[model samples]
Target: METSTASPPANGRVHHPGLRTLVQTTRFHAEHRPDTAAVICEGRTLTYDALHRGSNRVAHALRAAGLGEGDRVAYLGKESEHYYEILFGCAKSGTVLVPVNWRLTAPEVSHILQDSGTRLLFLEDEFTQVVEGMPTAPPETVVRLSAFGTWRAEHADSEAEFEATSDTPVAQLYTSGTTGLPKGVVLAHRSFFAIRDALASEGLDWIDWRAGDIALIGIPGFHVGGLWWATQNFNAGTTVVAMRAFAARRAVDLIRDLGITTACVVPAMLRMMLTEPGVSAEDFTTLRKTVYGGSPIAEALLEESLAVLECEFAQIYGLTETGNTAVCLPPAAHVPGGPLMQAAGHPYPGVRSKVIDEQGRELPPGAVGEVCLHTPARMVEYWGLPDKTAETLVDGWIHTGDAGYVDEDGYVFIRDRIKDAVLVAGENVYPAEIENVLEAHPGVAEAVVVGAPDERWGEYVHAFVVPVSGHEPSPRDLHTFLVPRLAAFKLPARYEFIDRVPRNPSGKILRRELRDRFWNDSARKVN
Candidate 1:
């Protein structure tokens, strides 16, 4: 219950050093920098004072709606100031905020809503039809984004008395269903602040935040990267600019116009922005750093990004379960042709990493195996999946399903995936998820999906199919059928009609064999 007064830190930083929970951060900033902008989205600005009071009102509304501690309140929409308000409100009221990826299909969306056992849903005005058309029923209380202002205004803006610790769960983000159904990764308040506190103690500027820093949330809030990055800036009491949805051209304009000093983006987003018409280094004059990750970046793309951005570049690598990034390739190691450029980088302060074999024994340096990370920022657990929670997380370590090795110098090099998940433009698209829908088509007797290298997207989903005797379906026919069932990113970019799919003696489909065909010419197995 310790709090700082309205006086700013002597170092010129605006954040409260004593703030531990998300609610504390909002309250601290509201007291010190009440008039400063906490979040700016699509020309709307929410000041720190307004955000704190607004979230207080939201917390009252949630309590009045009968939601209690640990209850899930789902937000189905794009990134906005309202989203952050609800996020902090949930933190204050002890409710967990579940942000759904707006791009997902109705069925995919339905699964998350049902799986999380959400009690209330905040739907965007545009997605009302999507929710209404859903095969499954939505929550009992559904509030549209258009009516949120009025609804929230009905409640008092006074702060609520709720006891929350650093370990209190604040957000539950769903994974990409690597095993066929997305699991909610429950993250607590510490997930956003633990690593920041660790690095601050070490005097490391690896991914430093400044007083006037204006960070652009390039990634969607539904993703760990976006949510983590935004909160990181907020913890520092800096200005945050979020996009409704990532558009390359619009991002460029925001950086130039808003004087965005730093941004968190994926490699594909960098590629698109660099290739955007009329974009130049001049447009990025105010941008001091660009933190890119979520997918592997080709050497060629990294080289171009460095030359064009003309700013510090840091690469991050981790998972939703690891609370975003446990490893970081700091700006200092970003040499034009350095060997470390190929590495996934070293673990951040207070983070431990190792490569482990299939039997769970730690592997030696230079040996390829599943990468494991232990960090204070790790997620609490997978909501409602005890077996999965035990399997992936053991003894406070996350067994990342990525095949990689740690070198003698401690740099991590990721070579391939231990899991059969594909990274499409920073989105995790599991082959099984796509194969399930593809096989449902009468034209496809059997189907196997894999990731294929692409110059544009880091990797594109490719499917190999065994067509039914007389009902051979063209790629177009299957694409049309799958469009309404899956997210656009999960759809196969290319399809191969074959007599049969390769399999082993145990009848397991040789997914790697089919995937190897696409990456054989490349040096790395993964794109």
Candidate 2:
């Protein structure tokens, strides 16, 4: 059973006297299960003892490079098990790790590197152009991942002289910035483990990570969800199977072969896995739980997964600023005729959520307003954006840009982004609602809604769609399917066929990218 009354003792030297930081957690695993597998990547496996010593070398190397408490170091690479070493090492040395999205353009990547003021950068070889293309000189110290071993070998495997408290800021995750420029979210290590601590206190296991649980992580390293999920399992001493990148077929094969007991994936990954050949119910016999988020899953898709995987589904809802998940719809809440799917579930223990109006006043349960969350896991601040930070985080509550309502049962109903709302003929239309309706069409594989410039209606609903294989859905075909499901004003006034919906590294639809094309030479920037 979950017990939080006393600290779980470590096997060796007490890192912090109690389970107070990520460094301590990793140390606990290393000392307790020295030979147990900690991470599995492409043909590479790191046992707990090996990871511990490797990270110790990394910490010594960072100190040798003049990095210490509060100094920032950036990592630009795809997901890899080495990321855990860098992260844990930084945790021990009191350095901040900034994980940059390698998928970003040169300018976008450059902006973050400069904005974060990182003293050193660990860049993958493939992304060297990101620095060469920068208008200014790259950071002074840069280490290529392929040659990372050489850098680490320069220093001995010894614990750093520094120590980090629970409140120390450990990560700087940049937001996708669909609306504008991305901001660096400064998060503390304590914030990352808040949910786990709460679950332990309540004698509950949200995802039930038993003794031999194995986890598969498909999300990219840039997002908090990806890093948080990995660290959560590492904290529990469970083996994590890492992926450099996610390919649907490979993911399916790994599920069938690797005995993945728990996984953290987005809705899109689930849909893609079903499209791979030779996949069946038996392929997922070992998967006991799946935590999915990033975007809402269609009812049909969720049902198909439920029927095939037959595993516990935990639908989480949170933001980069929330550190990870603040609310979750557990497996038991998922029923045929329940309100669970419609809601984002009650706030997790130690998390408080509410809906508020423009004036920051709390709204009644049924009133639609901005969703707000007050959680221990919330980020410390938006790095270098004090004005924006104050505006977004008020009195310890994050004013989420999502427009939704809290039900009487404390469940959250997320409609769409407040910024994405289209005011057509003075009626508010949420694109997520319209997209859900279009996705219900049998021939449509994916759909996204954005408002386009219009002369008469001020703004018109435009739908960008991706069709399933061997199917080409016409505007009329989609219109016919959506006519009965959506209100007259909510129906798409125009439809455009697209190869696929553009999503960020985290699987959040890039509506701005699609919407910008239609508004390119228009009079007004926003519809």
Candidate 3:
């Protein structure tokens, strides 16, 4: 609701410190933009001063409840101002903010809370029943965020007396279990600052950060975009407009009404926005940058987005383990050329990226191999899993497990994921979970889930099942069985009754073979 024309320094460089350690922009804005809108959601706005004070109050309340440094506090709720407030409050207290995906089933939710040993849980009105039902959830405490409650009026104007520093763990984001079970990725405050600096070094002009800029964040807050984008915006003293979830209509409405300058969306979300009913080009005028990632955006959809949004389109690629973005495809590179569409651009400053062979040897340009990244922005390790941590982080590099290549121009191009993880609508769905559910059905003997290209979701979940002796279930039957067990997004879009899933000598499902049928030589497969 407020506007400022001052741009960041023009040297394509941004000085970033730890989330809590960085006080320049934060303190400056707390004083200057106290009355300006900071976070806007569903017709509700919280100004800079209010957000800062609310965060301080939340921090105080957390500490009073015995939450402290290195402690994991589960944020189980929808996307709203409460999400950011709780997360930032955790940062202030040096506590680890574990944002639970609200879509998870009760059992799945229990697994996360138990696995992470979450000491406290902050719930929304919708999830109160779920938390109440789980008796064995960490045993610390649970608090609800709502207007009417026994919760005191704890909106403190003074900063909470909490230790917040660079080495503090700010987030413990769980990887969407698309390969095996989900693992908690531990990210430190240093990693956040490192990424901001890395992006600035990779040709991201700091001047782009205008204090008046409103970032339209439609992505779910549980993911990296929600965490990192908010950090970046807060560090630059920019305003953030939080949409609870991605609805194409709602996003377009906000873009037009709020004069949103930038938005971070996946390919599927972009497709929906471009094709939204009654959406006009004028609706996206204030929009300046459209950052697309999570999954590769096809050339066709990219061009369509360019035409419709009429803004600078940039591409970024990274995983949760790498603090979200390691490589970037700048707006200039997103031209009508063939190479630009496929290239995810250069690695960020202070980050080293390369294509590596199975032997860990670096591959040459144009040679497709596993993409490897080394950056200070990378996570410290997987929480409570030392062996797995070692396997992922070796020699200073975090194995991305994604297949890609580097062009002569130093741009990176993603080909496919080497990990047996299925990306359904940008959400990582592990085949093991889906297969486990399928095997639970009396009619299913063996099952495998794999990623198949889709025009709509970038990739769709596909299940290959082997029916048990004297029993067989149709696709509808499987759907019915899974409806109550899994989230709607994780449900397989297509089910194929197969004789036996392709496997090697070790009996590991040859996901490549299953995926090849759809993604072979195709940018995307709709079905």
The numbered model that scores best in lDDT is: 1
- Clash counts per candidate, in order, are 0, 0, 5
Q: Clashes in model 2: which pairs?
A: none
Measured against the true structure, the TM-scores of the candidates, in listed sequence, are 0.80, 0.94, 0.77
Instruction: Assess candidate 1 and give its TM-score to the true structure.
Output: 0.80
lDDT of 2 by residue, 256-325 (tens): 8888888999999999898778789999999989999988777778887888899898888999898888
Better of 2 and 3 by TM-score: 2
Model 3 ranges off by over 4 Å:
1-28, 132-135, 147-156, 199-203, 420-527
Alpha carbon lDDT of each predicted model: 0.86, 0.84, 0.74
Per-residue lDDT of candidate 1, residues 401-501 (tens digit): 88888999888888656666788898767675577578768677678889989889999998999887799999899999999989999999999998877
Error of 2 at 442 (Å): 0.9
**Deviation (Å) of 317 in candidate 2:** 0.8
TM-score computed on alpha carbons, candidate 2: 0.94
Off by over 4 Å in 2: 1-17, 522-527
